[model samples]
Target: MNTNKKAMMSAPNTDQNILKEENNNRIIHKKTDTLVYALGGLGEIGKNMYCFEHENEILIVDAGVHFPEENLLGVDYVIPDFGYLVKNNHKRKILVITHGHEDHIGGIPFLLKSVDIEAIYAPRFAVALINKKLEERRMLRGVKIIEINEGSRIKMEHFTVGFFNTVHSIPDSLGLLITTPNGRVVETGDFKFDLTPVGTNADYQIMAYIGQIGVTLLMSDSTNSGVEDFSISEKKVANAILEITKKATGRLIVATFASNVHRVQQILESAVASGRKVIVFGRSMENVVQIGRKLGNIKIGEEHFITADQLSHTPANKVCIVCTGSQGEPLAALSRIASGTHRFIKLIPGDTVVFSSSPIPGNGQSVNQVVNKLFKAGANVLTKSILNNLHTTGHASQEEQKLMLQLIKPKYFMPVHGEYKMLVQHRDTAIETGVAPENIFTCANGDVLLMRDEKVYQSSMRIPADDIYVDGNDISGVSTAVLKDRKILSDNGLVSVIISIDSRESKILCKPVIVSRGFVFIKDSQSLLKEAELIVYNALKERMKTRTTFSEIKNTIRSTLEPFLYNKTHRNPIVIPVILNSKAAMLQMQQQRALKNSNHKAASE
Candidate 1:
């Protein structure tokens, strides 16, 4: 049997004998058991995608993208490989979005282009965000996005899905309760137990009700599992912002994540309370404010907004600027203003800049750099600290995780949406909540779990779950080879050897010219460059002695020069051999020489 055909046929309706035979011979087997696996978000922080399949129906939770680190070179976002979803596209597929955050819905456009999703179910806020993204990509047509809420319940062919409100940094976040044939599984998107939250509170009653009924498995967020105690309330951050605004005598600038709608709301309200007009900066911030207002999440009046051109007339003490770059991104609005490069806004004396968010895992150095620059420009900077509670995380801490475990009372547990250490910590927390150690599973991406007869077990089957890098508009263009080449160019630079050759006669037309960039200075390394040029000339000459093809000649030049250069400089720069046909060059030279001869004859006459 063909592997692809066998894999596709490994659905629910296959014969028992065939399944047994395939199970013995193949890595993947067809069974009626409920299948649980992750295409991403198992051992890492971002690119979250989880799947639950039973019979002919498949339920997907959260298609997200991971922002590449500084070392990923030119990659924008890292999405999950959609090979499994596309291969099993014959099944009825439904995608349920947890929230509007980029880590949850950023990969929706990419997912839509790869697989055939029956429909997408999201909350009101996420619907707006997704529609805006799709519209920008011109992919809004034929895409079905239905709005759901905490009270909404969806009944599919093999599952019944329900949602309950959960408090997070963003509004309209929900936890999902999916009932499959084997048992009920709960997925807490991203939540914390905030008593005095900025927006709606978590639905504890619904959570307890679901727990009372019974939960076979629970997959929860482990982002803050390592943090001690409960997470701080958003209302507290609001009060801190209010206090800062009341005391500041100059212009106030607040930097935060654009997706933190509640923070933006508090900033707007604080500005209004302090009798300050608001000026929003950054494209992402502007878009979020617009969407938040359109959805009634933000309730500021139109009169509160003032453009940059009006800044000259406005008093510094009466103006408030809200922008992005809480993470200290180089191109963000706040960073530009801090560096004195912004066209409309610059750091003035006595300006109070508040960082309304903490630095993400790998952004501490960048945030410090930006803060240093801001302070040097005669401005005061405030970040999240014990003295000033300016920012609060949306993830639940250890105590909150314990509370969730006690409430859900799941028989089996798997921690999701965090690193490996965090997941292990969450597992220990679950153990303390009376869950058996054997019932807990800490897995990596592509690992499979099967639940049959209310018993869960690990399966030997694995799927394709590799990181698919997105570069610009192309999804599949950035391969490992491309990234390797980019790293080499960034580290060692590039060296190009251009040679003009007469292909018809298999003869060299001119000496090879070597150009170096980021490698070594040509004027200072004259002897080295001359040696490299001679090496290329000799390789080309020797290869052309036997009517060698252009490809062989180029390969010979590259192979000879690479080892020679590396041995000489201890650097392995990208070696590029440019083989130019001498036909055009020879013709141009002849024309120039003839024109010069004609000019001399005319001068003599």
Candidate 2:
């Protein structure tokens, strides 16, 4: 019977058998699950990471790092955690870069060290910038880099991916469309729909085509979705800058984001039109000019890139200084110029300093300090607030967000590149465009989203999104906890209290030892310390009667000491309690008490 069955199977036509096998393979592939995961930059605004999983293989998008908050002292940068994909090493195929922003590409060096990447696809300028970082890290080995342009496509096993041009402040920003066997997913990598962009606008036709083809998933930028208007263009800001230059009589200084090549071009144009030579200052500004000019994104006359020595000799009216440090970085050229510490150039009376950038959140205090320094240097200063429209955001606003949602019309929407509230706002915006409520996904760093046949599933496999604290070139995996501690220490000050107690009887042994830092000067705050020690002594004796364990005693001390300290000092200092098992000093005090008692008894007899 078995032999007859084998013969019957073999009797089937060869072409028919082959066709059946192929169909089986196709059906198995079509039924397979597909997933999208983010390594970073999903919930938070900075560290950008995403993964597409199909047929057991994964394609990664945009490995990046997050800049620290103001209180994150000593932190170098935060990289997305890749621990979840550590076991799936073989499935890792390609690292596709979206743009040249630091948050989008900064973690490449750190990430490349872990994953065995097959090839890296990025735009030309982005590749160049990443190469510089890779070289600096000394880990550029065994990696194949492919420099791509807009409208380029790559076909891989069970997938086809293409890059479409998107307008951002940086050149060659692109969006990605990943086509699975069943559907296509559109990802907008930090974009603004600037129709009047310097060189190219958002690819309207490509977006329309995606809408027509029907995107299975749409992951778009939600960084600026909270504001209810269109993002102002660089052209509009250029006009405002030109007007400022026309009115200023003294030396004109413009401080902007170094990567804002379009804004830099506008400054140069306004400078030449105002009969001044643009003298580029600051290391970052100079590097940007050199790179952009080399790449043909920026066109500048040889006379424009003048040295600081030439700037010193030129009359104030003939010089237009373009520099960095708009965020008030202490080491930036603008800070040096403001403080009159620059080697060749300094701000003087009649000079004008225009800050052509908005104060990013958490940077307001530093920016204000820099503005005060500039004013003290006798230079008139103009910031976004004083000269409204002088600076516009690179991210899209509410109207453009609506336009993007309408154009892409994705099956599943993931709002990314924003804080929690911002992500929520973007989600609501997507809903207004008629996307089903269940189809919307609001993700955070490390969370994974799985898409199968246009249905999405979420799992909390949060990647190891961490901050690497760096001083100079050294790197360490010091978490944000360290930063939080520093902030607390800075704001509330620190207080250490020491009190000796009898371990067996739970009795006070000595007066509390109090030390204060950043709280109050010892001499000035003597009375406060005295009263605090009294409270600690009283609390310790009272709690010692009931509290048995050291930790309980510490907690009791903390509870009592914190309130007393707060009441007396009007500041809450971090309280630390030190308890000793044996109090030899207390024995000494007991011996003195006995001697005094004996003397009194003898004198009375």
Question: Which candidate should be chosen as best, given lDDT against the real structure?
Answer: 1
In candidate 2, how many Å is residue 176 off?
0.6
- Candidate 1 steric clashes: 0
Q: Taking the tens digit of each residue's C-alpha lDDT, what string does model 1 give over 355-466?
A: 9999999999999999999999999999998898899999999999999999999999999999999999999999999999989999999998887666677677888899
lDDT of each residue in 443-560, candidate 2, tens digit only: 7666666556666655434445444564444444665566666776888888888877776566777888888888788889898888888887887777777747788778877998
- Looking at model 2, the pairs that clash are 41-47, 81-464, 81-465, 446-463
lDDT of 1: 0.91
Off by over 4 Å in 1: 1-30, 584-605
Regions of candidate 2 where Cα sits further than 4 Å from its true position: 1-31, 385-388, 459-476, 484-605
The Cα RMSD in angstroms, rounded to one decimal, for candidate 2 relative to the true structure is: 11.4
